[model samples]
Target chain A: MIVGERKPLEEIIESLEGAEKVLVAGCGTCVAICMAGGEKEVGMLASELKMAAKLRDMKIEVSEATAQRQCDKEYLDTLKDDVKGKDVVISMACGIGVQYMALNYEPMRVVPAVNTDFLGANLDVGEWAEYCQSCGDCVLADTGGVCPIARCSKSLLNGPCGGSADGKCEIDPETECAWQLIYDRMKALGRLEKLTEIRPPRSWKTSRDGGPRRLVREDQKA
Target chain B: MKSGSNLEKVFEKGEFALTGECGPPRGADLEVVKEKAKHLVGYVDAVNVTDNQTSIVRMSSIGASKVLIDMGLEPVMQMVCRDRNRIAMQSDIFGAYALGIRNMLCLSGDHQIFGNQQDAKNVFDIDSIQLINVVHTMREEGKILGGDDIDGKPEMFIGAAANPFGDPFDFRPIRLAKKVAAGVDFIQTQCIYNMPKFREYMKRVVDMGLHEKCHIMAGITPLKSLPMAKYMAKKVSGIDVPQEILDRMKGVEKKKRAAEGIKLAIEQIQEVKDIEGVDGVHLMAIEWEKKVPEIVEGAGLHPRPQVS
Candidate 1:
């Protein structure tokens, strides 16, 4: 399940401080499972905004809608009818979902109600953390499922950096050295010899160096 | 807004307080409710008109508040987010303020499934924390929920609920601290029964330094019967009366339970009053308003010292 937290209510209220009618749009995919931007949350947000407006003696109309999966255009299309005539839409989806809503609804304004923190799974109820950066590269097979690209604060691939001391990352005392985790995993799997092969310098071009990349499959397109 | 001029302010200002709750009419013939408001006028500082309290529908909170205000009793309009969207919530809040309903309680509201409106859609557009923050933002910063600066802000005496006896105990104080940080001026705790447990919880809150930041009013609900006590213990999520108290209730006869309940509630008030960091007590008679004055008097809590 995707783990995330709703942005502070004050910030959300500030984001939509003016104009009358507002639609609170929720995503039912990862954000739903995380209990951040789901149908339930959408209703709650709408109710709170309504009550707040009432306290201020100002007339602000709040409506709520939820998309099946905000990142998917098919699911986002569900909101087309709901967004019509609404002054502003507060999106409770991930960053991707927010962009998708903006792309689909050109004239309507879309605002994020949650901070897209990171790609992490819930270790337990109400706990979440960063796991992957999705840097358009894969090196986990040699590193025993630990990605130095994400785990190493510096994204180092080969061995541990000078910051690695006593098997922990110096930059963050809470973090274990990524290479240390790699060494232990490889040793347990009897694949320590894999570490002996020094990897060639990775090409930065295919990564973020190439701004905003896309891929298409001709066979699938037909 | 208007700084919540109801009876609650008297309590805040070191005056005796009188408070009551509106049981919203079961069916819409509001005469019974109006009479109930009339009965409370001589007694309470403010009457809290509940908004779809317990998720059971009745006359709208705005209407009830207006009735209470007209009846010569200050009304603390209890507004919940169970039924409206931000638009309606905002309008109703201002509507109440305009009509002189100042004291407001921001709640996430009860689930529709629990009420007769099962098919009704739930619009949680916001939770208690956010709702309180919205009121706080408007009152302190002069900004509305939409981020637009208001020509004039609502002067509301903001309040929130706390359940020290609720689950995730370790997280409760932290969450309460978060509400305090968000600008809660006062808090009405879930009904407190087990005094020792409540004292322990109060100590923890004081240790966290929240006691000084906000006024804490302990909730007191007089149980009318052993069965009622059992029902509250089993049905309520945040209240957990100790086994000793429950046992004592069971030992009493059904006819004597109401009196017993009042005695126990008075005992609770007396005990809680001496506990450090406890600012006051909120007597939630739960449809037993006649018994509140008795309970207060029995506990030696004089409303007049503060009322004048």
Candidate 2:
């Protein structure tokens, strides 16, 4: 689950000021669970946009439609027909959804309705927070479930730095020290001695540094 | 001689007025809104354009009001603070007033979590009370939201929604009093089906002496079908159609339910109007505008006084 927040309505309306036929598109996957981009949200944005347009004395035609998963081509193909006639497509999906629509519908102007923040899960209903950076590395097995890449201000792989203050990080007093959490978890597992092992420098080239990444499954392909 | 101030005169005089509600189109089709406008213009004193009613996005209330204005109808543009903060909402008030929309209905709007676009963020810069106060601030204090003085202020006839049918009934009058205290000139309540409950609620307002301060309009929407009645009873918050009304609607065939709804609505209007406390009635036909005149006439309300 990825957690994110919505942008202000005025900012979004400003983007679509010149557009007459606006399509408020949404995604029903992660964004739906997070209460960000879903059918209900798309309908609301469409209505708000219409209200704003009315005040401006401009005739804005707002249409609402939601896809299953905006990051997938199959889901985006569903909107192939509607996308052509729209002057602007306000995507309420995550950044992936917004870019996916752009990749497929090259002609239509795609705008992000939600500011995609991080890959995290809901703390509870109507609340969400970041948890993962998707660095393409799985060190959770060595460090308990906490991801230092996201929890630690500095993505230190081996152990906590000198800045750990009373089990909390110095930069963010509100955040628990990721190293402290890791050390506690390792101690519980009788692996506290693992901290003494020095770690090699990180190789970030395997992640987004390489460029857009892909995963191929020859067995699943037709 | 000025029409705008002349319109204000009637409202300030405590005269009874009629208002109707219209939801804008979901798509860019103007014809659909125009068709609804056809049934509203000239029949009612003004039409209330919903701003994202039920938190579902559709065409803008402002655009729909313009269409209503083009059709020679006065419009009360509904403004909800759900999507906008203080800056935008204040600016919109001035902008709408400048564009000739003089009436407004302030609301906190539905939470975004309930709408079709669930991922949409919410900016609750202010609640309904603050919004009403802002309008009053502009009208009385003659200043912008930022406290900058203006030579002239925006004069808006503001209204708010009341829920008589909501449970823990004690809170209703208190909420109404709060809105009144915030400078709300009038109030349009949620749907009123059970006159006894509404009458009982009004007694509280009378006890508080609020009846003399604000013009109260009873909201009435005819139950088009048994399913619609059931839906309203179960799904729609702040609305409760009595079992008797549902039973009355249940016996009717589906084809004739619309006519039955109009008759039932007329009956409601007749009951609510005869009550001494209710100043007027706000009819929310809900995509049934054509039946408004029928309901109005059925209730024996003439557009103007008859010659002796």
Candidate 3:
């Protein structure tokens, strides 16, 4: 799921500088799962901003709201009353959510209260590691179901670079080396030959290098 | 000669080829490059021009290679995936090949935080192996990696870096085999201060018979002083310096330690030269370019073949 963390209290407070009314909106989907900019986070941010405003002796009204998913226009449109005439609307969701709020409600400044990180899985409590690069092209089958694009520090397709040490990336020992995991996974599956297969250069068309991508589904568009 | 470059010719004739490294100046100072080239000429078969080594911004490797080419020295331009994307890298490879540069050493560049610039974005679009395959595919098939044909391609002898002492030690030779499968013609390993470990690595290479497929040049850096040895042992990753080596350096007097370091390096050069799978030695006399002639001559690798 999309991962993100809330912006610092100081930065959120500063963005609402001289603001009379502020709306803090959260998403109940991906961001919530990652424990980032979810409904609870929205309330925490709103309360912290209110406390800061009081300490600074500023006149501000902090309100909190949450949508089932902020990336959807329908979910965002339902929050019209909560965001109506608010001096600034702070999104406690991912970047996609912030953009959706701005698209529906214009001229009212929309700011992000969280820094969007990556699409990944939660390994353990308070631990998240990226698992997908959204490279558009997937090589999981050839790589024992591992995503090299997001795991390998260099995005090496063929195999690991010389930096794999103790099954961790040379850049940081804490980060697991993606290729090591791929090799071990392949070995366990008795498909080690899959690792020996040389991979050609990935195409940019399916990657972010191609530019901002948009997908349209004719079958689902009904 | 596959590349028709002097380095490839040396490797082809089965001579213990010697290569040196000449880092381009951080600014536009071609004179510094020429001076370094002067120190390496006649003593080494090729010179590796580092590309923003350690991630600090420097003169582009292609530009530095051009200077070396004009100075009658073969420039092995070192390329890394840290700075450029695929489009930019391919364009630069073609540009370098078009201008008489024929050799390259692909590397996964150091993280930017190690250098002066900590805020720079790292673009590892493809690792060194993928990079080698790109150039190799272009040369063999006369096509881009995406299967598009081009009028010309980089008919260059490609090389990559190896680290035998790095962790998951069992995976080093396997990684080299993968590089060869990706179409690497030659390899220069990370600096070697640990001989037993490197010999063990080469034995594996021989066991896998990778030496028959590609040339492997052992990397040697003559320690300048005891402090330098300590720094390399502690600060540098993937470099294994055994306790005996450090003790040997300590055994020498302060004034004579530099010469002792050189002697140890010459010993390494002589030993690795006999290692069955090892092809040659790459002398990275970093910041000590002037001493290259001495080391090469002392190691009996002087008078690089003048074969055209």
For all candidates in order, the CA lDDT equals 0.74, 0.76, 0.87
Q: Give the CAPRI rating of model 2.
A: incorrect
Worst 10 residues of 1 chain A by lDDT: A157-166
Candidate 3 lDDT by residue in tens digits, B192-269 = 987888889888999999999999999999999999999988777667788889999999899999999999999999
User: Which of 2 and 3 is the better model by TM-score?
Assistant: 3
Docking quality (DockQ) for each candidate: 0.02, 0.02, 0.51
**Residue B211 alpha-carbon offset, candidate 2, angstroms:** 1.3
Kindly provide the TM-score obtained by chain B of candidate 1 when compared with the true chain B: 0.92
Our model 2 lands, by Cα RMSD against the true structure, at 21.4
Candidate 1 recovers what fraction of true contacts? 0.00
Worst 10 residues of 3 chain B by lDDT: B165-174
Stretches of candidate 3 exceeding 4 Å from the true structure: none
Candidate 1: residue A37 lDDT (0-100):
96
Best by lDDT: 3
lDDT of 2 by residue, A7-113 (tens): 79988988886788988998999888788888888888888888877887887888888999999999899987778788999999999899999889987888888
User: Any runs in candidate 1 off by more than 4 Å, and if so which?
Assistant: A1-222, B1-4, B15-18, B306-308
